[model samples]
Target: MYGSQPARTGRTTLLAVLLAPALALAGALVLLAAPAHAANAPRTSVNPVIFVHGQEGSAQQWQSQAKRFSSNGYRDDQLYVHEYDTSVATDDHAIAGLEALVDTVRARTGAAQVDILAHSRGTRVAHAYLAVPERAAEVAKYVNLDGRTAAAPPGGVPTLAIWSSLQPNGSIGGAVNVHEPQAGHTESATSAESFGHIYAFLRGRAPLTTRVLPELPTSVEIAGRALYFPQNTGLAGRLEVWRLDPATGARAGLLPQHVVRVGADGAFGPLAVNGRGHYELALVRSGERTNHFYFEPFERSDRFVRLLVSPPGGVADSIDACPGHTALTVVRAREWRADTEGDDRLRIGGSDVLNAAVSPRLRQILGLFVFDKGCDAVSHLDAALPPFDRIPFLTATDLHLPADAQARGTIPVTQTMRGTGGIEETIAVPNWPSDRHTVSLLFKDYADIPSGG
Candidate 1:
């Protein structure tokens, strides 16, 4: 219905049609009144974004994503498409591309650094800049988009390595990339809703800590190993946290109580990240009634001990929890809910289909991606169920994540294993490029409350 009008026709309708492009572009940027050609601010200008495509791809690999960002607000000048021989080791021309591109972007924009978003082997090319040493300062942020390289060339420059799910080999942290989804990854950028996390993570924001609901201390842990309360069980203790809504300013969401086991051996957490990106308890106390909530981040043994004596609120505040606290890991949207013949399906990016007006049953806001596949690729005829041909999501089995996902994506995928706490391991991964990867985890104390209500 919205067709372009011929110019100089002098028709009022023609003028309206011609003005559309200018208006649409203006809307993409937050400001409507800002002049279209106004020069961006110096030093604070948005650094150029160099996109490194994935395997089985081309610059066309980013065609859908590129158009999406442009429609949202990103200008063409800010996007640089770096193509390489996917067959080669990726160092030869890729390194040369990075060196030349960084200098060009910095010189042209007068910005101190440039940002990079690379997929799969593309990430390898982007990181190689660190080896040059001179160009390292020219690059501000490097988003290893699903590329699983954990080796960090010693540099103080902060890096946010994005991954799809928890993969053992993918971590630059001193320890293995933490598997706790409730606590976001400290070393790698892991989240289920990759798109929604792009903005803040690109800006260098750490995981946002949640306010455990207002409640009195009902239970206490005697030592780092045991719980003393309504029931003295073999299990150590459990955690109960209320979810705070940043928008409504209320406890709109909540996570089930997570328990930790105390064996004669030692302390560990078998927590996991679920498809929705929430922390799932893998183990619960052998036997117990309801109890208050307390959570201590997995920092050092001292923090675990401090949690035992630590006054509820401020006690665990500064401690670095396993996986960083972020909604990106927890945000989810229900897709293909009405499917009759196929299995349930969901979109794994930060795009939360659950919270949309389409479904009231969806009560959570998890993620938002700047560039999303609106499914323009899938024919409107093929996506729809039958008479109503609306674009639909893929089946459960088809939801795969981008590369490097398992290495980083699982921090928010914790709700799967219900238990106390220990170390949840990835058992089996059935999906890829997924909101939640098919994996197993080992938690100490945890439980599963009926969700999707």
Candidate 2:
């Protein structure tokens, strides 16, 4: 039921052709550096990698690293993401789902073993899966990212534990521990530095390029799933893909580029798109508000684009909806740190939202929800709102951005560099009334950090 989708089988052969020159150069270097034993040993292939996400996390968290791997030489078919419901009390269901995914990956790739990478709460689940000798035998390597610590590597597998600045002293007894002082909790998993460490640990050599190299616009294609938040259940709806004007984030045309009826699996697309183009993915359901997701750009073919939504009249429905204001949620894989020196900056409608109360380092906020708190039509930029601030990995702000659904206006959202620099990115999106439309924006965690060249 899981592996039958076209996305699971679609291979990015075009990427290989484009990267041949770089790959060939890197291949020669490996041969020259090989030891006598390695030259005599059987030729080995890169193992299929399966990524497991943490609590309230989806496969989207691994989006950037997956692209980096592909750029370095991994095929589209060789990467998999195990998405599970993180709200459950125990790891029983997560372990089962991961085991099934691992088996499926092995069956399709025809490999004896696969590599596992888990972050945050997912480390516990991965460790539990590795506890069984049979399961451990199926894994070639393991990466524990800013998650659990142990006296020894789980199941005695070769492990790499990556700790962020937040956990300065975190480590595992029998694993290679690398500390990234510039990153926060989630950033340690998505940062280019983290990718370098992971690639070296898994491949026994540094990556040819840690960056997510871009493909030509004509060669870029995308596909993904629309799932219920926290449950990982697919949503059946009408999905519309519309190209947007990068400057103002306005629709390019009246008609969508592609219209699909998303099935129970919530899978859609293998649709071609411009690598430099911005897009809006609108998920529309009958008698329900449309959830509109905006992305910066698809620099390459992406298969893990997740559109997470809650059921109508569900958890999200509890949000205060009003016609007088626009509601927006900005997401980045990196944790926002507003309480620290030289902290990150987030500006919406020309006002900075990051503050000591709104984005404390300990909160490790990945999603920042902005709206008029209590429909009071007042802007309180100094502090975070209740309920949302209490939630893990999330925070909310009360900001008044007037909107008219009939005639939309652009609302500029700017993110300045964490340290000293001018603006890093500015994504201007339309101000849609919160009563009928929901806006979500995706931002890269390492927007200013370049990978190893």
Candidate 3:
């Protein structure tokens, strides 16, 4: 039942043949007259959607789309990202993988069919699978994101073809072909507009809400990206939102009000916020807290807000001075060296220095000095040589430095009895900067300590 052409080459030629003036016009006319459906209509239960990524792509590619789906009421279990070694595997092998994935999803969800969405080279794998008689019946629908196929109505299932390039010739008989000429190939897979169309096609209705929410009624929406400094590239991690007490300006509770995973592109929520108040959004890696951003929701004039996670010492007054700084500002923990066996003491000209250190790369050292006496305060001291007496009893500095500065350097951490320990890091800096020219660094604790050094 599969098409006769060698998997890759024929689709392009077929597209050319199909794009005759008359057929193109017919397809356009059909697409224009398509009826619009109400998003709030009693929705039908949809089968799981299986996403296949392009060559050199990973399952992470689907993160934003998956969260978008989750925002629209689809559970995590209802979405499947089928990852494969596209470079090493043949089309047949990839199709076999897809087949197995589909079967597993079907059995787990107990749905009669699943919808398939494939991008770029992944279209070949989907087409190969759909061309098989047995597999054809298992898909309720298919979405072709910037991919070409010779046959109209690929797999004979209802199809929606979202194109980023020139309109394809000859319609896939009875399929909907959408032309998003402005979107890039990757954009077609991640854009909100594309998600709207996919949502409609898969659910047979429009989306009630295209953005993510905090599981509560919301009056405003917050959306933005996360990245690391110097390189200013997107970050993939978890975001925890906590509500604050307006009167005391303290966290209301230990549990987060909402949490969502940021995608590989660093794109995060259209997170729903209930009303104007104080909130703390924490960016964490794995489960370790890395950075905490505090803000008042009402202070924002617009529904959308932008947050830049600056590098340790590069949080200059303006973006120009910092250049490409996106590291998490601070790494904090309670009593980082409390019960350790050795005395880590820092002696600056005979007297014991308890708090802070000087990094040659930074102009200043910023940290929270936590004392054994049950009080904490933020201290901003010179990076070159912090005075012995000026240092606090216990301190945790949120160090910042220039984007191009050395990431691996020696910083001293000490207590009167504990002596001195050097905290060194071979920082894993991000490779690219976000549109905002910001990126973040994961905080590393002490590497080695030479007591009385």
Candidate 4:
């Protein structure tokens, strides 16, 4: 013992850091005035938000999030939630549940389009309905809450994916599924902790984006927790909040206050929004919607595979546009382009915006990543483009990686992801590629820190 009392403690700490969950601080809450134009907004809107739970979840999973909306002024007539199996043919289950929900929302809202907020298997379900000729007419907006179904997302609907961007280190029991590409399984709607952001999106408000991108800390330390969650239950709006704890992975009440920010983490990228603050979101791949922007720790001793949590704030579009080893490129966002295009043009983020460009070297990598986070991927950006070379995708194929191995797990989204219900998951095109040169896009995020003003 005389050799060292503190020395032994240091060894344990190192072991824990390597085997613990990573935590990042989220954005602070602030109040702001509603835009003046919001008052004159149209009445008959698209599909009302329909929350779909994952795995063994019940309708109660959405209770907390639904309450957040009600408290924030979202009408009850515009809110809905669904529960599906974590076991069985995920595709079949999604198709049946989604079709019914579409009919209900349409009849209830008396509107043709319905916005969708689907989680886990629900993502598959939502797209399945969109594939149905009778149902596509109902969805105007779709926000995939980390639902990883089939492969890619279908076209036509705008999407937003708040993904964790990290991999899971756990196993389905005790077997490690690392490199499986489908390892870190999480749902956008898994926790009651996401209520704040959920409500913000419903009414079209801006989510906080980090002013500074945080670098990974030198070491990580996760202490004080084990894991235990309810095995099976069916309540939708409130289970994740009232029953399960993301930190310890227990079934105890996870009070909203327990949600805290800790440790340095990855860069929370910016989002695009208009005067009303409704920004478009999409996933880099289709079914990958299962990746939550934040993954909470299931076991305090587990590192690398933290549980999925909501974004610390704002839009976290998983966009990596690099052409080759010579250069890295990011798709330029027209978010800040002057509206001389007209007031009708999509408004840029608030007054202060940054200007970043794509390196000419990376010009050949031009196809768009079907946003698992927003409206029809190609169509959304295409609508804004003047037209050029059009390359349709397989919804299940990746355009960037040709080797197939390096592109493992992540699927390339095409016009038709799969056949049946999968078609809805695949996006459709209204026009073909033109022979003209591809139009240039504006990029904002730069991994390389800006040198000066």
Best by lDDT: 2
Residue-level lDDT tens digits of model 1 in 1-453: 000111111101000113356657765212111112113422335666666655422343343333233323344455555654444543677678667766766665566877776666666776666656677777776666556565563233455555543343455543122232322221122122343355455544421211111111211111122222111112344433333222221233444434344452223332221212212222233343222222222111110211111122421122222211111111122111222223222233322222223211121111211111232222111221211122121111111233243233222122222122323222111122222221222221112222110
Sorting all predicted structures by lDDT, with the top scorer first, yields 2, 3, 1, 4
- lDDT-wise, the better of 1 and 3 is 3
Candidate 2 residues lying further than 4 Å off, grouped into runs, are: 1-9, 13-44, 312-315, 448-451
lDDT of 4 by residue, 45-88 (tens): 43466766555343434543443343243444556654444445
Give the clash total for candidate 3.
38
lDDT of 2 by residue, 8-114 (tens): 44444223324357767775222111111212334348898989999999877899999888777567677888888887879999999898888888887679999
TM-scores, all models, native as reference: 0.35, 0.90, 0.43, 0.33
lDDT of 3 by residue, 163-251 (tens): 86334342355678787764445556766678889999888888654442222223344555554432234567788877866443346
Clashes counted in candidate 4 amount to 85
Quantify how close model 2 is to the true structure by its C-alpha RMSD in Å: 5.5
Query: With candidate 4 superimposed using the best TM-score fit, by how many Å does residue 390's alpha carbon deviate from the native?
Result: 46
Q: After aligning candidate 3 to the native by TM-score, how far in Å is the CA of 84 from where it should be?
A: 0.7
Question: How far is 228's C-alpha from truth in model 4 (Å)?
Answer: 19
